[model samples]
Target: MEKKKELENLLVSVSENDDYAFRVFYDLYYRSVFRFAYYFLRNREACGEVVSNVFVAVWKSRVALRRIENIDAYLYVVARNEANRYLKESRTRRRCLSFEEIPISLIDRNSPPPQRRRSR
Candidate 1:
């Protein structure tokens, strides 16, 4: 109860653009955000990126911090969104074939058209 009240006060301070309070908030919540992101993104590098994005979001939206009821849930939601975005981009990368990956035969415009099988 006391801790929750204290956190609310901290949020108010953070909302007022206090760098020290923001740093304290980040120090307290960074690990939780990182772990939540890690659960979605198993790769350390991707998780690190997600964590950085989450904190950047928090800092950018500091003015709205006081309006948030549950900071933990808010942070987790942001982390999850970032992780999902990374996963989505990775999927897109896998689906897109680079120019180098295209086979030489496919690139040969003069190649004969593939023969269609005749109906039995």
Candidate 2:
């Protein structure tokens, strides 16, 4: 509870655009958030991206930080959403093959064009 109160104070200062407060908040939450993301993503690169994006969002929305009721819960939600989005996008990308990605040999080059029948 004391730690939560301290974090709430820091969040208030962060909302006022205090750089030191923001730094302290980041330092305190970054590792834990990263670990949470890692457990879900299981990929170091994706976990790093998720953690970075979560902090970036917090920094960008610092002016509204005070509106957040629980910083830890907010960070966890953000990390989870980002990890799920990344995994979904990766799956979609793997399933979608671009035109250039198709092998040329697989195309039927000698296929005859269908002749249009004369209109009666």
Candidate 3:
């Protein structure tokens, strides 16, 4: 199809580190990837983060762009993987923060002192 050929040309240019081609490729895919991530993440901020990380990864691996048979499928897989990773890490962070062993001394040190009762 014409669109596939256009994407292939853009991908080839991206592999060569052409900024304009990369921008075009990003523009073509970003919204779809974000929506895919949001479907799994169900959080706006997390979906945004996943979309960003997916594109960052694509840019980093641009040299391999030529080998990708389906850019849409590739982007969706990356988005899904990043969203799952984000969810796992978020769960781990919340679990760690809820530990009962956390020292009270580690809490904020600048708070006002507790007031004493004045009644005899």
Candidate 4:
């Protein structure tokens, strides 16, 4: 509970244009945010990239963040949304297999075409 309060105070301090308070905020949140991004991305490099991007944005918009009631939740939501967007955008079209787009030729391509029996 105390930790939460301290974080909120740090956020508010930054929001009030105390630029130095961001160092405290960054130290408090960086690793946890990276881990959260990792959960969604599963790529260390991509997760770190996203986490860094989000934190930079947060610092840039710190003044406007005064109204955030919960900085942890807010930053997490930002990270999750960013990760999801990154994953979706980076997905390969070929790997995104659609049932309807199944290659009927694949069934025949690898083996002899199926022989159909005629019923009297």
TM-score of each: 0.80, 0.78, 0.81, 0.67
Best by lDDT: 1
lDDT of 4 by residue, 1-120 (tens): 997777778878998878689887888789999999999888998998899888878978888787888777889998998898778777866477787776666545877665779999
- Candidate 4 C-alpha RMSD relative to the actual structure: 7.7
* Deviation (Å) of 60 in candidate 4: 2.9
What TM-score does candidate 3 get on C-alpha atoms?
0.81
Model 2, poorest ten-residue lDDT window?
A: 105-114
User: In candidate 4, which residue ranges exceed 4 Å CA deviation?
Assistant: 1-5, 92-120
Local lDDT at 69 for model 1: 94
Over 1-120, each residue of candidate 3 has an lDDT whose tens digit, in order, gives: 998888889999999999999998888888899889989989999888889999999999999998999888888888888999999999998778554666555564676555678997
> Regarding TM-score, does 3 or 4 come out ahead?
3
lDDT of 1 at 114: 62
RMSD of each: 4.7, 8.5, 6.2, 7.7
